[model samples]
Target: MKNLIIIGARGFGREVYDLAKQCSGYNTEYIIKGFLDDKSDALDGFENYPEIISSVEEYKIEENDVFVCALGSIKWKIYYTELILSNGAKFMNLIHPSTILNTNAVVGVGLIVFMNSNISNDCIIGDFVTIQGYVGLGHDTRIDKWSHLSAYSFTGGFVVLEEKVLLNTRATILPHVTVRKGATVGASSLVIKNVKEGTTVFGIPAKILNF
Candidate 1:
C-alpha cells in the first residue's frame, strides 16, 4: 500500500484527515502517513493527528508516497501543489464515500471531494479542484483546475467555474452562469450572471466588490 501525505496541517487539513478515514479504500489501498507544513507547530494543540513530517521544502519524494493538497487559500494551493509536482510527486484523489458522483462525470487527478457533495451528470471537474461538504453541482457544470467550492455552495445546470475560482460558503450560481479565472464569489452570495476574471463578487446578487 502507498503512503498518503497531506500537504496542509491546519483546519482544512485536519478536516481532510477525518474525511480520509471514511474514503472507500482507506487502509487497504493507501494509508495516511503524516502532514507536510512549513510551520512546525501547526498541529500543536490538536490531539490524535499525524505528525508534521517536514517543511514542504524539506520533504524528499519517497517511493511509496502520494500527496493531496488541503490548503484553503487558492493561491497557496496552486503554488505549493505545483512546487511538489515539480519534484515529480504523485497525487491521489480523496473523495468521501458519501459523495454522490455521477458515472457520466469526468474527474481529473488530485481531487478532494467532501461528504454529501452531489456531482451531476456530465459534470467536468478539472485537476486539483476541491468540493467542500454538502456542495451540489447540477448537470453539465464545468469546474476548471484548482477551483474551490466551499461548504454548502450550489450551482445550477451548465455553470462554468474557471481555473482557480473560489466559491465561498453557501454561494449559489444560477444556471448557465460562468465565473471566470481567479474570481471569488463571497460567502452566502448569489451569482445570477457571468463574473469577470480576477474580481470578487458579493451580496445577494453578487455585485463586484469595489475594494
Candidate 2:
C-alpha cells in the first residue's frame, strides 16, 4: 500500500482525510502516514489516524509518498504546493465521492473537490485549485491555477477565473464574465462583468472594492 501524507491538519485537512477514506482505490489499501502541521501539538483528541510528521520545513519528502495540501485559501495552497513540488514531493488530487464531475471536465493536478460540488461538462480546473462544498460550476467554465471556489458559490457557463482568483461563499459569476488574476469576489456578490487584475469586488452586480 502506498503512503499518503496531509500537509495541513486544520478543518479542511480533516475533511480531506475523511474524503480520502471513501476513495476505495486510494484509501482502502493505502496507508495514511500522518500530517505535517505547525500546530500539531495543539490539536488534542482528534480521532484521525494521522500523527504530526513535522513542520513544513522540517519534514522530509520521499518519492514514494503522496502529499495533499488540504488548504482552503488560494494563497496558502499555491505557496505550499510550489514548495512541495520544488522539493520533489508528489502532489495528489483528491475528489470526494459525493461530488459530480462531468465526463468532459478536465481537472489539473493537486486539486481538492469537496462534497456535493457539481462540475459541469467541459469545465477546466487548473492546478492547486480548491472547490468547496455545494459549489456549482457551469459548462465550459475555466478556473485557472490556485483559484478557490468557496462553499455554495456558482459560476455560469463559459465563465473564466484567472490564476489566484478567490470567489467567496455564495458568490455568483454570470456567463462569459472573466475574473482576472489575483482578484477576489466578496461573499454573495453577483459578478456580471470582467474584473481587473488584483482587484476586489463586492455586493450585487459586483463593483470594485479594492482597486
Candidate 3:
C-alpha cells in the first residue's frame, strides 16, 4: 500500500482523510499519512492525527509517498498541483466505494470523487477534477480538467463544463447548457442557458452577475 498525503488540513481535507480510510478497506491500496498544511491552525481540532508534514515546497519527496489536493478552490488546486508535479511528486486518484461510474464513462488521472456520486454513461471527466459527495452527472456530460462540482449539484444530459469551472452546491444545469472555462454557478442556482467564459451566475435563472 502506498503512503497517502492529503494536502490542506481543513474540512475537505478531513473529509478526504475519511474517504481515504474507506478506500483502504475498499481496495487495500493506500495508507493514510496525515496532512500537509502551511500552518497548524487547521490542525487544531485534528490533534489525534499529528501534523506529519508541511507544504510541497518544504517537504522532502519520499519514494512511495503520493498526494491528493484536498482543496475546494480549483485555482489553488492547480497552483499546488503544478508545484507538486514539477517537484516530481506523483498524484493519486481517490474514488469512494459508494461512488458509481458507468462503464462508458472515461475518467482521467488524479480524480477525487466522493461518496454517492454518479458519473453517467458516456461522461468524460478530465484530470484532477473534484466531484463532491452526492453530485450527479447525466449521460454524455463532459467535465474538463480542474473543474469542481460541489455536493448535491446536478447536471443534465449533454452538458459541458469547461476547464476550471465551478458548480456550487446544489446548482442545477439544464440539458445541453454549456458552462465555459473558469465560470462559476452560484449555490442552488438553476442554469437554464449557456454560461460564457469566466462569468459568475446566480439566482433562479442563473443570470450572469460577474464576468
**Scored by CA lDDT, what does every candidate get?**
0.95, 0.87, 0.89
Q: Candidate 2 on 61-166: residue-level lDDT in tens?
A: 8756888888777777777777877888887777878899897999998888888999999999998888888999999999999998999999999999999999
Tens-digit lDDT track of model 1 for 54-156? 9888999999999999999989999999999999999999999889989699999999999999999999999999999999999999999999999999999
Q: Tell me the spans in candidate 1 whose CA falls farther than 4 Å from its real position.
A: none
Of 1 and 2, the candidate ranking higher by lDDT = 1
Candidate number that wins on lDDT, 1 or 3? 1
Which of the two, 1 or 3, has more TM-score?
1
Residue 16, model 1: Cα distance from true site in angstroms: 0.8
Residue 88 accuracy (lDDT) in model 1 = 94
Could you estimate the TM-score for every candidate? 0.98, 0.93, 0.95
Q: Number of clashing pairs, model 1?
A: 0
Q: Candidate 3, residues 1-211: lDDT per residue as tens digits?
A: 6888888888888888888877734237667776888765777755556464776679888877888999888888999889888988898889988999897999998899999999999999999999999999999999999999999999999999999999999999999999999999999999999999999999999998944
Best candidate, TM-score-wise?
Answer: 1
User: All predictions: root-mean-square deviation over Cα?
Assistant: 0.7, 1.7, 1.6
